[model samples]
Target: MLMLRRTKNFLNAHGVEYEKEHVNPLMVPERVYVLKFGKRDGEFLNRFIVEHSYTWTGRDKINKITLRLHGQKHPREFANEAKLLQYLEKHADRYVKKQGNKKAGKNS
Candidate 1:
């Protein structure tokens, strides 16, 4: 919960738009943050989701932030908020919607 709050605060402070959603309502019940940045031909060019997870068995596990990027086979886990924020800031980009007729703008 604390990790998620901190992530949300970072996103808000950075002016990064994101969506909050549950990973699985019935089974997982974990909430995740989805963010889309940059665009190509009106399609999202970069996308990623952040999730928080922990375990309660044996020694108590510390909360970690998981970042899953599109087209990646595995997700990257981060324990430091600054590093995660730095990564997100580096990848985040402003999306400008293309103007005028799409097909006519292309070369013959």
Candidate 2:
């Protein structure tokens, strides 16, 4: 929970816009958040969604983070918060650039 809170704070402080949605609660109480970019003209801009699930009590207690990116069939799972943050920081700019180029191509 602490790691998730820190990640949310970091995104807020960096002025990043993201949408959070709750995944199936009956099965697993997981939260899925996606970083959004580009113009919305009724077209879906493919991006990555981060899904995390954690529990504090019981033997089933677990803290897990997974990232599902564009053009990738399999999701990349992170064992810890540091690695997840590092991955986000490294690829976020690239996605922004790609989105800009996509918009530019449409204008041309």
| Model number with the top TM-score | 2
Q: How close is candidate 1 to the true structure, as a TM-score?
A: 0.42
Candidate 1: where is the Cα deviation over 4 Å?
Answer: 1-3, 9-16, 22-62, 94-108
Q: Scored by CA lDDT, what does every candidate get?
A: 0.54, 0.55
Cα lDDT of candidate 1 equals 0.54
10 residues in a row with least lDDT, candidate 1? 92-101
Q: How many steric overlaps are in each model, in order?
A: 0, 0
Reference-based TM-score of each model: 0.42, 0.51
Cα deviation of 102, candidate 2, in Å: 18
Question: In candidate 1, how many Å is residue 58 off?
Answer: 18
| Residue pairs with backbone atoms closer than 3 Å in model 1 (clashes) | none
For residues 1-108, write the lDDT of model 2, one tens digit per residue: 233556666666655555554444466576555544332454334443555554464323325566655456887877766787788788666443233334445557
